[model samples]
Target chain A: MTKKNSEAWKKKYEESGLRDADFSSISGRLLEPLYTWEDLAGSDPETRLGWPGDYPYTRGVHPSMYRGKLWTMRQFAGMGTPDQTNERYRFLLDKGQTGLSVAFDNPTLYGLDSDHPLAAGEVGKTGVAVDTLADMERLFAGIPLDRVSTSMTINAPAAWIFAMFLANAENHGIPFARLQGTLQNDILKEYIAQKEWIFPPEPHLRLITDLMVFCRDHVPQWNTISISGYHIREAGSTAAQELAFTLADGFCYVEHALKAGMDIDEFAPRLSFFFNSHLDFFEEIAKLRAARRIWARHMKKRYKAKSPRSWLCRFHVQTAGCSLTAQQPEINVVRTALEALAGVLGGCQSLHTNSMDEALALPSEKAVEIALRTQQINAFESGVATVIDPLGGSYYVERLTRDLEEEAERYFKRIDALGGVVRAIEQGFFQREITRAAYEYQMGLSRRKKILVGVNEFVNTGRRLEIPVLEIDESIERDQIRRLAEIKERRDNQAVRGRLEALRKAAAGSENLIPPLLEAARVHAALGEISEALVKVFGEYREQPFY
Target chain B: MAEQRIKVIIAKPGLDGHDRGAKVVARALVEAGMEVVYLGLQQTPESIVRAAVEEDADVVGISILSGAHMTHFRRIKELMDGQGLGDRLLTGGGIIPTKDQAKLKEIGVEKVFGPGDDLQEIIDYIRHWRAAQAR
Candidate 1:
């Protein structure tokens, strides 16, 4: 864009009534009504974007991209017992799901057995409950672990759950090398946003590093840690915060691995990211582009990673669950489609379109099918995926991408000044920032500055939602506890005791915890038992006072 | 006689980590001059009821978005009764269906606020309830 052309465009924009209207992105970033060559006056294509598959991959990490193969349509579906979720998984796969994303129930996520008092009423409520290798076997019943890529949204006890998964695969005679999946072993994000941390940050990071090293050696195809901004965004972070904080956490993990004497190139390639695709269309696309570019540059320049594969920032995206409104719930389908489109446009390797009933309850099978079909339509009918980086060079998009990058860099500096992400987390820096953003956003809605269609405006009353809300029977808790009790009765208690003893010793020392975890899982030690063993050594984390 | 400031305990009594609604409602209560004791994420019903009794709360609002509202609310109700804090108003809001909300109210929940309900309504309800208690 030339100076003269930019000046002419600005003059035209000023003259136009449309340009005079108030404008801002969803994150409150100012948006120009008209963008021109002047917006990119400083942007050099090669330096800024490079090519789709090249260094500093602003466009995408893959050259052919979606043209060669469509993004993996992974619908995150899990609720009730393992048998029920197993059925849901098969249904989704039968309905053209390219991959599986498991949503563990609160009990499983908290590393508690279904029989625990704290786990009462929560077993398999939010997601599938897996208390032991037996539940894992049932959860993946008849589904081949080697054939499909699975992403489990679990933290805190991710190593223990993953141990169960490996044991399940071995029982099924599937080689560990053949297993392909991602573990949401992102404890940093747990402390920062989700509030699901078990141990303090240091020990949690040790567990993560252990998983990374173990996966690097055995399950080479597995993504050991999915550095997640999805939960951060869901926790009310702005787009820039999500980008900056998630990348910072990724860098923290990289630094941890390096400190543990692991070669960056050996493990970095397996590092994956999960981001939220919110309502902001262009901003999300720009955020994804900026994310890839920042990651590639940092890996090459800052970390000095030797492998070109290490420079690729492969990511999965799920449509924002927070955006699904309870009022006029059917319209959430449209919102999800748009968000999914943005994710696809932004070059996600895998995507999950949130179901319409998400705001009300767990997605019904019909809702899940629609969510899956939304991705299929985008891939087959929309023709948007026919080319790589389809919206790469647009003046508006490029300007937005550059702006997002700059904002994220500013945040990176802020995080660094606060003494890196971990210290920032300890100081409640991330929580405060996210809380303020959430409060402001809520205030915006109340003040009518932001119209949420059916929520703030276009008001509908006396409307009954006829859509089926999936009811999780309370009997699930009883069933789960009974099963857990049976497992405890049947498993070799002596072997379990020995493994837990060894686990306690390892936890006391600085040992890679995966081997002990695997041994315990093999002995059919319950998730809570193994987690309790570690908690004995590494005391549990209680959040520093943050309102 | 000087009026006591209304004490409230905002509780998350389930596994669901979605606390946006709870935090928003807590902010409203705080703005309304109520002292709030926030029981953070993944709290059990017994813990919530214990907090309510310990905080000497006028209201015990248990926010649960997960579908286990029936179990949690019922459990909390039982604990509240056992703890002899039945006078403390039990109220909450989430993705709960109107039918379930009715059932919950029938089972002794004071009021059930659904999604997008006016925060002022919550404040007004709590204040009104507190006044009735005093009377």
Candidate 2:
């Protein structure tokens, strides 16, 4: 009957000239018209979905998912210098933000300093720039280190950045045991999608494992990693691919730690996930629901994680930036609002809405606030958060969630066939899948099958109203470079070199690189210097371009 | 002798690692029957200019997402001028706002392909510009 309904819908679509119309995106995942128990044949809904916070917990993670506590209203924001980022931090905190998430500038992401030769023209151009302990100190200026959970979005030099963060907090009267926040120390996503990497994979994995072990020992409040699918979706992956590949990356990280002799309960409790809520409304929600079920089942059955906290697959969701259009920029606000609503309905732990103006540039302060308010309205006004997984029992939603789960499971089998994430990454499996998805999405858009409101349909002509944009001063780069040089002149060169050499020794040996890194950051050895030592020891990573 | 196809070097010239645009543009050029050499991220203007010369590319295309287009394009232009390769075709593609696009043209960037600009249009522009120069 559902098949017949889908066929009828397809027929109606065809009769309405959707065949000639651009039905590529809207029609890609052909849905069956009316789903019944037959659509969920051979499946026990109760056992599969279970009760809230139960095993194979497809219904919802928490017994009181949002009724107990509303999701974290954390929007990813940071730009210009660390000082500039601090001002934004205080602004967000004052405006009811509950978390502190830092976005490192491009040079910082690549383990380069503001003064490095390659960093010359790019310091503080993309995100916030942090070079040394002082820069990290200034970034947190007046904010209390122990009070807020700070998440730093840095890879490659995640160890160095986390080290500086630890040093800064220690100086600010916070103990290691009190550290709370997440570091996006997921290197798989870097190699797979974001491409901000320094050392080769093996050594990089070692550093990541070190962070996991050290944090497990010291910072119990800290989430040591957020295996990110946000970038995978940003790189244009299908929902199934994003779900499968991200969890696969998580599984690989677990296996790495497990092999390093860490207990499943010790580290798994702090593991967190990050996802992208794309413009496809029901599909994005279904992806999140399916992800929770998949992660929960995998942990229980495969790893035998003893703790319920380990079973709880908490994730932060960001509305898709790739979905925003440059042609009709304002409509992106509506698109982001819908996507944010899906995140809420999908039971995301935290949400970040993309500003409408993001396709053209970094959002203006007003645009970012509006994006935040979009989430706020959904929370306080829309009243969607009052219910946990409100759409869970809907036959349509439940089936879609199952369909996404099965499809993602198929992808998992294929990755397993390819011998897991590392082999697949080396073989460029993730890269190939995402590139194909990106191509297909663009093809849909170009064929005029996907109606991007401001771009293709319901056009707004004669609107020359200029929105205020974030104008970056070119002098920021020069200023940053000069500051880096001054820091270079003051720091003891021999001490810095000594710490870096010790870092390299640790890297080349069996020792975890974090302690040496913290020591290096304490002495003001720049992030770039620490990375350069590892690069010398491990060599620079060069990825082969995909054909 | 067979006519040598137009060669284009598409480079991602800055710190932004979002290469979907760069990769898509590279594929478009390949589909257009051009020999395209894609120099991936963290490329200095020196590296780009050198690659253009080494590949003997007829056109050099720079894709920026780090929003440092003004400084990056200026550096490329300066390097091109100093190396006496100013006559070589230069173009850029990315999220160039209208105001910045205008300023970029003023700074001697041959053409600017902002978001949603057609790949076919770019190929046509490069062809027509080269033809006009020949005339």
lDDT of 2 by residue, A1-547 (tens): 5678777776886676434443223326876545665666777878878887786667677789888888888878878877788898898898888888888888899998887777766788778888899899999999987888888788889989999999998888899998788999999998899999997787888888999999987888999899999999888788888898899999999999999999999999889999999888888888899999999989978999988778878899999988887776887899999999999888888888999888788888889889888988999999898877888777778888998899988988999999888889899999988887777776666556676666556666767446777877778878777777889899998999899999889888898888999999998888888888888889988888653
Task: Please identify model 1 stretches exceeding 4 Å from their true place.
Answer: A1-22, B1-5, B82-84, B128-135
Query: For each candidate, what TM-score against the reference?
Result: 0.96, 0.95
Candidate 1: what lDDT? 0.89
lDDT tens digits, residues A1-547, model 1?
A: 4678767877986786562223787888888777776678877998999988898899898888987788999999899999999999999989989899999998888898888877777888889999999999999999978999999999999999999999999999999999999999999999888878789999999999999999989999999999999999998889999998999999999999999999999999999999999999999999999999999989999999989999999999999998988888899999999999999999999999999988888889999888889999999999999988989899999998888888889998999999998899989899889887887777777767777878878878788566888888878888989998998999999999999999999999988889999999998999999999999999988875345
lDDT scores of the candidates, listed in order: 0.89, 0.84
- Give the local distance difference test score of model 2: 0.84
Error (Å) of candidate 2 at residue A278 is 0.7
Which structure among the candidates has the greatest DockQ? 2
Colliding residue pairs in candidate 2: A2-A34, A5-A33, A6-A33, A22-A449
- Model 1 is docked with a DockQ of 0.54
Every model's DockQ? 0.54, 0.57
Highest TM-score among the candidates is held by which one? 1
Fnat values, one per model, are 0.44, 0.44
Judge candidate 1 at residue A490 and give its lDDT.
Answer: 95
